[model samples]
Target: MRTIPLITVSLLALAVLAAAGCNRQPTPTTGGEAKAPPAAATEAPRLDEHSYAEPDKVKTKDIALELNVDFDKKELSGSATYTLDWLDPKWGKLVLDTRDISIDKVVGERADGNWRDLTYVLAPTPDKILGTKLTIAAPERNKRIRITYHTSPNASGLQWLTPEMTEGKKTPFMFSQSQQIHARSWVPLQDTTMVRFTYTAHVTSPKDVMVLMSADNDPKAVRDGDYSFTMPQAIPSYLLAIAAGDLVFKPTGPRSGVWAEPAMAPKAANEFSDTEKMMETAEKLYGPYRWGRYDILVLPPSFPYGGMENPRLTFATPTAITGDKSLVSLIAHELSHSWSGNLVTFARARDAWLNEGFTTYVEMRIVEDLYGKERADMEKIVARNELKKEFTDANRDLQPLAVKEGVLKDPDDNLTGTVYTKGAWFAEFLENRFGREAFDAFLRGYFDHFAFQSITTEQFADYAKANLLDKYPGKVTQAEFDAWLHEPGIPATAPQVTSARFDAVDAVRKAYLDAGTLPTAATTSKWTTYEYVHFIEGLPEVMKPEQLAQIDGVFHFTGTPNGEIAQRWYPLAVRSGYTQANPAIAEFLTRIGRRKLIMPTYSALVKTPQGLQMAEQVFAKAKPGYHPITSGSVAQVIADAKSGKTQ
Candidate 1:
């Protein structure tokens, strides 16, 4: 989900233009007079306006972190030493973003190898979105500042799970989801996507547990609970991730592997057996896989998102481990982010479409290459349906893909299919307008030029105009582009995707609805998860119990191992008042903490009085296992229902 808030700033707008490799030349006079450039044309120092950090004043270049993981206290105590570069010596102080964290001390390293304590303050002006601004004052002579701090129990970024919360029920697990602005809650740094820094970490954890970060991770090495990691490639703070648990690794390929609980390791490895091929396919489309090895850590069921594209290692949810390869498209999607997001990112939360949209488009391409055009089309069709639903139901105040004005109260609200589905359709629109071969070249060049930098939507629009649209003159008009990017809803020119597989599924759905034809195993024995989802989602919202039973008897969806299908089926059963499915619904809700699955099921249940009571009971039992990110939203769902508000 899109986490954090939107704080529009002039610095953030202009910085991304340069970061995206847009070269602005001084305009020459009409009469051949070479006049001096306008004063306003002078570039502003790149700062993440959305972030509480004043990076333009004092920037972070690299970080050296020494930390100990205290599982007992559910805290990470660490000293984060930042190698900084001062842009203005007179600024007097460096500001960073901090959430629920305790600052022990702040010290600066002098040129003569002397360390002195620096006066730092957690600002009295605390913000719900930006967190607290940590201001440190010290002499400009010291280019290095180290902050000793520890995460508080209230740190929303870190989820501490008990042994009983895990699959094996033998060891506890802790993982940090630091996207957008949550990084500050764990470690004091520039918690914006705008700042890029290389980092080396020395981590101490329990001897029985293994730790991994978004860096060069060694699966086979755990030296007496002390582990060291390095990420040479500079990355945005949002991608800085860490996880520790009793984990084991199983190699899927020479350069690809799976990390999960010992019991889940082999299953996850086999499930993502195509990881190496996905990397190879993505590289062929974009460029070489820059991060030496591409691996995946199958996180616990509670990992909110389907997958987080954390540089070398992608943190994935175990939900994707369906025995069939149908769900590996999520892996493909994350792999594509290696080029679109990990290598390059959005300058601010406002332009999140640049990261997600591009990745979604690339994911479709990779899926098409490996699977088939039909499979890719089916994915797009599902996404398009989701986008239409979101567009119709979205709060009108919220901006669309390319938000132009107004600050987002919470960036996580922007985590709609608009960014993923509409964004992909927009890319598809561009590809259709400017031939596939040309678009391919443009994408490869775009990534190569802006590698490891944060860019804005404006920069991307300008780059497209110069590289693609300019060549084709009036083929695509600027107004059309504006409508696609800056408008508040789906554009009329959006690509329309269709799938024959879904067509067949829809026909079957109609047959069931019209003539009460119960589909047997033979009818859908060859169907993929996508087709199953389409068929299940197409079922009538209010179905007779006997009809639901007949369908459930044939499909056994309640007992299905596929999370995707089960997520849809259980919600429908609840809305239809199929009490027999309640036990399975409760089990599903308690076991899976993915927001995508949890929210819909609970939301559907809360629509009726009885269902709302059921939802509350299940949530009470399940809340402890969910990450804050999921539980926070689920709590609101119940609260809204109690107040007679629509979801």
Candidate 2:
């Protein structure tokens, strides 16, 4: 996730020094180094990361209280007050994790208290004394303690995050990514799993603009004009979110809606129509509609992850719009979080796959319901292919979902295909094994039992082992989970091919035969002597004659293309090869070229680099009302390459 370029992962060896110890306590830093950047000033406000856990909650059943965020055109108005439960009888120096954040007002129960600010590259060290530690003879279990302060916004090492643009200006999207404990970057609180607190956030923006947060609005979930909203949800500081933008809401899916502004709303809503069905399906499968109504708001181009599942409202990247919403599975991915993540949460980042992958596996239900199984498979395979491109044998720096919290070197990149794609694969594998009915029953049982609670990979594995072992006894074992999770590799189990209908070689060869003859599944399903003849005839002129000989009988090409293959192959014949290398390779190299004819191949070429590149080149040149046909992979490739590595 760091921009610093290195030839190989060798640089990661040095990276260990930056994050050596996860439990190192916070120590105050000299305030003179640099001032904390303001929170996303104009965009939605975010939740403080370290504020979620309540060490006192272990003994005192008091829930943590409201976070006050004011983004008025004044100073960065950031303040938090921890109102403890009145029942628990205990008191200690109040713990809050403040990163680049600064304190402006700290008013303990009686303004008689001491607080410390801590600083370390990896952890915050408490040092700044807040007033003096004077125990206000208030209830140790239930009492109000406010820590108010103003701080600027920061990239926080997550790059290109921004709110949707208004006119010529772009607002800053306010949200937090607490994956590896970056929550301390904003607020001060014990950033640990040992604490669980109820959160209510007050986000103030403009009088006309709407404010959305992690939870559906409490009784306070309602809006008071355009500028303010009170969201009541039992959110860990990490899941806290606020996105403020000029969003145009499209009310299509019965309480379920998709948001967009002038330029994006109409299309976004139209594209996200399936969201309604997904919302409905999720409710039926996952127990109740917890996030209230579902709303997906598209952020500006720079929005960090594909989607941020901030409880009720999801923050998604506009870059995925694809004009037609052709790639909106991200919408479903986020929605499933309502159950997998927002409900059955993860205790730490190490087992994050539970949150992300669970959402992915269930996401198929959402997509398949609306988009049909075939299209879902088509899109998923395309995504998987993109994931494959990022790995170089998939073993370097690999860690399981059991990884410690806030410790992964590159947190942003950690949500790789490994978790997203492979995790989805694991889910799919389970579904295929158990059959949809049993899988759904198991998932529902899991969510209903664990809803509103945190779950670990180990816990889930235990659950799976107990339940799945009856039929799949010993198959879904700790060993199976360790191999799939704790260890670095893809799950070795393969899905049973019911019919054994498809052949990769046959598919590739028939594609060649059907080059001029538009291929049908039947023609491309068999690899025989005749198919070889079709391939030779369809082979590109640039292909070397010898290369043709190497794969002469193989019928399919590998990454290691022989000189003969490369030379004789025309870029068009195989460049955007996914479905058209005669038997294409999912590629995005060439979006539709300057010539619109290439546009016809847009859908077919979507999963390849060449197709995406071509689309980008073509889009760079606008011929009026013409939307660029670039694929998601091209955009990502450009980002990864610019960031200095392929993955």
Which candidate number would show the highest lDDT if scored against the true structure? 1
What tens digits encode model 2's per-residue C-alpha lDDT throughout 1-647? 11111112223222322222223321122332322223332211212222333353222223233343344422235566676553234333343445555555444453345532211222233322111111111222225566555544441312212232232155433344443454555555555443456665555555445555555533223344333334555555566555554555677566777665557787777777777777777777766777677777766543435577777778776545544455577788888888887888876555668888888877877777776665566555544654554555553454444554445544334646667777777777777767778888888889988877776777898787777756565445556655666655456673422212223434565555455233445655543222233244344534444444344334444321221222223343443332234322212112111111222233323335655565445434421112111223234444554454542
RMSD of each: 9.6, 12.4
Angstrom error of the Cα, residue 438, model 2: value is 2.3
Residue runs of model 2 more than 4 Å from their true location after superposition: 1-75, 85-91, 110-142, 155-183, 192-195, 217-228, 323-325, 393-401, 404-407, 470-478, 496-647
Question: Model 1: clashing residue pairs?
Answer: none
- Give per-candidate clash totals: 0, 88
Over the stretch 1-647, how does candidate 1's per-residue lDDT look in tens digits? 10111222233322332232211222222232223334446434435555767666777999999999998999999899999988876655566888877888778887888887665445444577777766565545368999888888768899999999887899899998998688988998888887899999999998888899999998678536899999999999989999999888899899989989989999999999988988888888899999988889998899988899998899999989888888899999999999999888988887888888999999999999999999999888877776656665456444377775445657677756767877888899999988899889999999998999999988998998988889788768999988887777778887677787888899888988898887677878899999988888777777887888988877888877788888788888887878898888889999899989778889899999999999899989988889888988899999999998965
What's model 1's lDDT at 427? 90
Q: After TM-score superposition, what is the CA distance of residue 89 in candidate 2 from its true location, in Å?
A: 6.5
The number of residue pairs in model 1 that clash at the backbone is 0
Candidate 1 global CA lDDT score: 0.82
